[model samples]
Target: MWPADIEATARAIIADFTARGLKVATAESCTGGLIAAALTEIAGSSSVVDRGFVTYSNEAKIEMLGVEAATLAAHGAVSRETAAEMAKGALARSGADLAIAVTGIAGPSGGSAEKPVGLVHLAAAGRRGKFVHREMRYGDIGRDAVRLATVRTALGLLGEISQEP
Candidate 1:
């Protein structure tokens, strides 16, 4: 279940991608498969949604999305580097023309001086090297709020990437 704005955005993406004959894949970490779930929640989403990877753990990110261990080691799982790699990997592995990745620490815990609980990194990659990255600091919001905000931002990134020629 998604809010009205989120569901609307997902529907718009599905329709636009279908019209453009473009497909998308998702590689998710903290938001799990919510991006994919949002897209697939719409009717006829199968035409635009290729696959979804719920890579919640480091091993899953490495194994499923081909995220490098070194990148994870250097930048941690929630960094821009890992998010970009995840997006690129998803695009390479799937039939989709576009891919988006989301990694974050959404928690009442897991806060550090550098990486706080509401810190999120999102990346979108498209064919022909089209890419975009966004880092959001949503403050110490509740876990659900943080995750929902992430889904919204991730969808926006996908929309932005889709606009590229």
Candidate 2:
């Protein structure tokens, strides 16, 4: 089952974007299609959400979102560079005014010494070339928590983009 607050936040984001005449898209990795699912749970989300890309694998990220293989090799799939490229590619591939990308290691076993579990990289890109990225180290918050947090943050980013000039 989905988080309870996610639906509320998704509705708010959809309302804000629809009011402002902005269309939104998502490029998701660790969270799979949860963000898209949350947004689509709202009744009028179709007016604001143009598309969603569930690029859960490096190959899928490369093929669907045009993420560079060099970038993936250099910084792995959970880096800011990859997230930015994912957001940019999503925006370019969709008819949305803004796009959000999420990539992370949300697991109980993928934790390394350097990049532990719950190290999420998020990015938001706009058609006007404006881009914003954030690196979140949520520690070993479990897979479910990490994915829920990522979805919440992604919706917040969409809300923030709606308020931008």
Best by lDDT: 1
- TM-score for candidate 1: 0.98
Candidate 1 lDDT: 0.94
Question: lDDT by residue for model 2 over 46-121, one digit each (tens)?
Answer: 9998999999989999999999999999999989999999999999899999999999999987879888998999
**Candidate 1 ranges with C-alpha deviation above 4 Å:** none
Task: Give the lowest summed-lDDT range of ten residues in model 2.
Answer: 156-165
Q: For model 2, how big is the CA root-mean-square deviation?
A: 1.1
TM-scores of all candidate predictions against the true structure: 0.98, 0.96
Task: Give the per-residue lDDT digits (tens) of candidate 1, residues 1-165.
Answer: 789999999999999989999999999999988899999999999999999999999999999989999999999998999999999999989999999999999999987999999999999999789999999999889999999999999999989988887
Native-to-model Cα distance after best TM-score fit, residue 18 in candidate 2, in Å? 1.2
Q: Which pairs of residues have clashing backbones in candidate 1?
A: none
